[model samples]
Target chain A: MKKHILTGTLTALLTLGGLSVPALAGPEDVVVENAWSRASIGMNRPGAAYMTISNTGDEPVTLIGLATPLAMMPEIHETKTNAEGVSSMSPAGEIVIAPGESIALEPGGLHAMLMRLQEPMTEGDTFPLTLLFDDGGEVTVEVPILSIAARGPED
Target chain B: MQRRAILGYGAAGAGAVALMLFVGWWQVDGPGGPEPIGQRPVALTAMDFRLTDHEGNVVGPETLIGRPTMAFFGFTYCPDVCPTTLSDISGWLDDLGDEADEMNVVFITVDPERDTVETMAEYVGYFHPAIRGWTGPEEQIARVADGFRATYVRVPTESGDYTMNHTASVFLFAASGRFVTMIDYHEPREFAVPKIRRALEEETEGAT
Candidate 1:
């Protein structure tokens, strides 16, 4: 009887603290959502993945790199267009997310460039991706491959 | 008296229908629609450069002159923008249906170092069958880009590799080899198809 009461009290305390459900959800403080990629055009072509990373904890976290079995080298890249409407892509450095903030990796902006894809990423395919953090921790996400003309996760 | 009242309502209804028709025409052809930036067509003959197509045939601006042309500059390595644009072009062509055969669509490479003839051939094959991939010497690419007033630059990445920065607009030209207008990147198909149709119509009228 006492053990049961103690367990009930602990659950009540956790619920009152507003950390019961979400705290038990994942071990990492960062949350990755809407991970998606477009289908590869053809063989020997590269691919890209986009997602939104949210730092749910009170401390800031840094995203250092990415990894996937599908690509030879998965790197964070960003596409920037100039004032004259010239677009370019370059490797992106470490991304820092403050507590309660979210960083969106989207089209025409920061994204994961999958270099030298092992095979063509076909539509209706899903793959696992790992996001390496600065503190040696990582988060794994499932990325879904959409149509080549897909503009976002919703598509 | 009731019959006259009914006739009066019918007359008002017809007048309203006519007004709506006029308003619709005004929206389509008036200042609301897309307007050509340049009043005069820029002659493609003014530019002279040679590049090889994906099929390994040497082609110059003269080859593009006889048909309504839609040209874009991008590299095969481009993952997001280039592929998306190519897919959008395919959708546009699909929307055009049989009329697509009346146009010349070309994909010019800004990164000549990586996009060889073979690479371009494989890359373009994934898109609309009508698209012709072109690549050649860097200087010749520059010559063609200058003729179109398009710009490109090489940008180095942190990984010691490089990428290209180039104009994102698709240039449209009439069969007379004259510049008609530019279709901005990510422009919706509803607007893009009409621009292409206008270019094609310009050619058809010229032929007549």
Candidate 2:
């Protein structure tokens, strides 16, 4: 039962990685590293996933989708603030990775919102996740879940 | 010989009971619980505002009154401060165990344009479910922010994304909703948990 719940939560967070294909797929390269989920305890519903993405190709590549067996749906998302002094989170259409550059999806910034957990995420658990890019290429990664208290602001 | 043995057993039992009581009392009054802020006492003032939770419920100061409340002002879009702070609160609550039941945790959105009741709820839900989220109309939110002395400003970027710069502090209120102290953003566990323990103990003692 616990395993099912953890899987469900990861599925919800990974659901955001899916996006429409971009017009130009300049480079065929994308790499994700250090992807992990924020640790939480009982009755906690949603969590955030963080990682670093590196584009090693000569041309820029866009990350469009993410997938994992843990969720029902996944979509690309970004946090944006409006003029009325309100901050909101919405689906990111595409995340562009420049050539030889890396984007850090750390806390307080662009992160994967793992929504609608099937189970509570305890500390010391790991979930398997996959990142899908526009050029039909994908990377499989393991996200370690840690205690919410252990996560620092910079992480 | 039998009578002497009974007396000895009675003495041992009494000693054991006394030791247990001492340990229990020490744990309750230990240094790890909430402590009073030695500096200026934070004043809790009431402000009326409208905001929503992830489940789309209306929330304001009134919702925080029944229990000792720990409130923080932040936006869901904050890249670093908001999530880390809230995550710390969640961890502290876990460490608190049953003590959390007597406290109400609140996350107030400074940016209400995007943080409708539903959005606030969704955002807050990422943390512990016991934490309540509130955000209302812009004017009302502004009033509440001012009352708490929390600050927020929006800066625009070329990519069509904007960032909000705001003060990050957790405010603790008595069960009666009087301001207690502000937990600095960086050391919530070290600073905030002890204050919460102190508040709960004080409330319990007062009731007795």
Candidate 3:
């Protein structure tokens, strides 16, 4: 009778352990946070998007593409200055997020340009965006629309 | 009787000639000469160049003609100096009331990399919507700066970032797009306003 009790206890413990495996798996390996865009001005105005990308996986991830409902095309850009005192902006091939590291996209630096808006983006509106990673994974986030003067100091 | 009349006429003519000579001598010695101001008037003329505006519009020296223009060079990310100068100019314009309508204020962004036409349009609107901002292809911008004798250099920082050191003078252009004078960043209002006023008056006088 004692040997039969030991076998039943082992079987119960194994079943309980199997049920908790999903909990240990947690969520996705790559996370995107604080995704936002500078608000658009008028119907003809263009807007820019900014965000922070954090990678939790052991392998490095590359951001190969981006998309937004507001823009016809989304592109990653960097500002470059030449010796002749002119400023120009060009496309960045890819943004790499190393394992256990975060990359920040901010003003006056690397940022995503939301080109050719379908409609005007007004203040207090939120736009949906999706970012595509090189590993065939994607994340969706909402970008808050703000006034053009939002980031500037009060007059 | 005829001889006496002739002698009186001769005496009157001699007295009139002598009076004219005395008046001319006094006028030469009086306040008609130049003032005793220590320095001679320096001609503040500058050369012209072609550049592009925030709308990618081609603008040349001719754009400033027909109005008194105030031109300043600064960057969009400048934390203090650039904004303050622009704000002050806006306030000064407010004080000028109807006079401001005839003036044109321009802000040229020194940082071309970050100040695209779209960025400049947004940045310039923050100060005052009336103030026009100009940025161009790198070569064009450099040519304009060099023509104005403005100096700008980039210094690398420890973080691999860099800062630009540039001349901070605000240039004044006449109605004909000729350089009239310059107001240093630290020029007092007592000095600057009067000079600007004089330039305006001169422009008006020329027009009339």
Tell me the DockQ of each model, to 2 decimals: 0.27, 0.10, 0.02
- Report how far residue A38 has shifted in candidate 2, in Å: 6.0
Every prediction's TM-score for the first chain?
0.82, 0.69, 0.73
The sequence of per-residue lDDT tens digits that candidate 1 reaches over residues B1-208 is: 9999999999999999999988887778876654433233347889899999999999999999889999989998788778767877888899999999989999999999999999999888877899999999999999988787778888775445666788877889999998998887756779999999999999989999
A58-107 per-residue lDDT for model 2 (tens digits): 98777887776554444445654333223445566688888999987766
Residue range A1-155, candidate 1, lDDT tens digits: 45434543543355445332221112257777777899886645668999888998999989999888898789998887655556778778899999999998987788999886788899977776778888877666667788776767776
> What value does the lDDT take at residue A100 in candidate 1?
95
Tens-digit per-residue lDDT, A1-155, candidate 3 = 45424433443343334321111111266565555554554544446767676788898888887788788767776544334322334567788888999876655456776666787777656676667778776665555665544432122
Any runs in candidate 3 off by more than 4 Å, and if so which? A1-155, B1-48
Query: What are the runs in model 1 whose C-alpha is more than 4 Å off?
Result: A1-33, A39-45, A54-62, A96-103, A116-125, A134-137, A146-155, B1-42
lDDT of 2 by residue, B81-195 (tens): 6777777788889889999988888888877887777667666767877788877788887877767766677765333556566666677877766777767654536667898
Error of 3 at B45 (Å): 9.4
Q: State each model's TM-score restricted to chain B.
A: 0.80, 0.74, 0.72
Q: Order the candidates by DockQ, highest first.
A: 1, 2, 3
Off by over 4 Å in 2: A1-155, B1-45
